[model samples]
Target: MADLAKEAASLHKAASGLRTVRQHTAKPLQEFESASHDLSALGALGSLLGAKGDIEEGMTTLVKLAKQLDEEWETEAKFMGDVSDAFDLLEVLLTAAARAEKG
Candidate 1:
């Protein structure tokens, strides 16, 4: 009975650890931590049989990271396009002025 109590206590600790990992962390910063807990929960079915959707939750974190990357890429693309167009206009203006002086 004492051994069973110790086993139960160990299970409870693992359960508490998994919950802490899930509730306390968010994307990017908690990515690795969430993964570690998820894998542990997978190995121990007793702790994670109900939260099977955590894998999808992990994917959601990745989706957030992807969205952030897309936003940055779009910002960079717009800035580059604007700069290129400005240079084109400047070159045209400079050429027109040179022609007028030559005339």
Candidate 2:
């Protein structure tokens, strides 16, 4: 019973740490999205200026790369959310264990 309590405490600590990390992760992702939007605006301006075909193509490639990066970050965010859900489940289990121990 004491061991279970220790394990629950450890898991709670880990879950809190993960929540902090996840919050920090969001800031950079938002910054990246903002930068991507700025780059897309630059790409549009370059098109309006009649940039050389090769230069336009390069800009397009960069935009695509930025989009890909955004997608990857979104996937990572989803994974983090899933991990958070798992933590919630662990917390629930811990609560049940404590209740059973009391009973």
Question: TM per model?
Answer: 0.46, 0.50
Candidate achieving the largest TM-score? 2
Tell me how candidate 1 scores on lDDT.
0.56
Best by lDDT: 2
For 7-103, candidate 2 gives per-residue lDDT tens digits of: 5556556545544564565576557545644554556766687654555466557656755765665566556556656666676788899899999
Q: Assess each prediction's global lDDT (C-alpha) against the native.
A: 0.56, 0.60
Which residue pairs collide, candidate 2? none
Candidate 1 C-alpha lDDT tens digits along 2-55: 444455455445544544442344455456645645555465573457554666
Which residue ranges in model 1 land beyond 4 Å of their true spot? Answer: 1-57
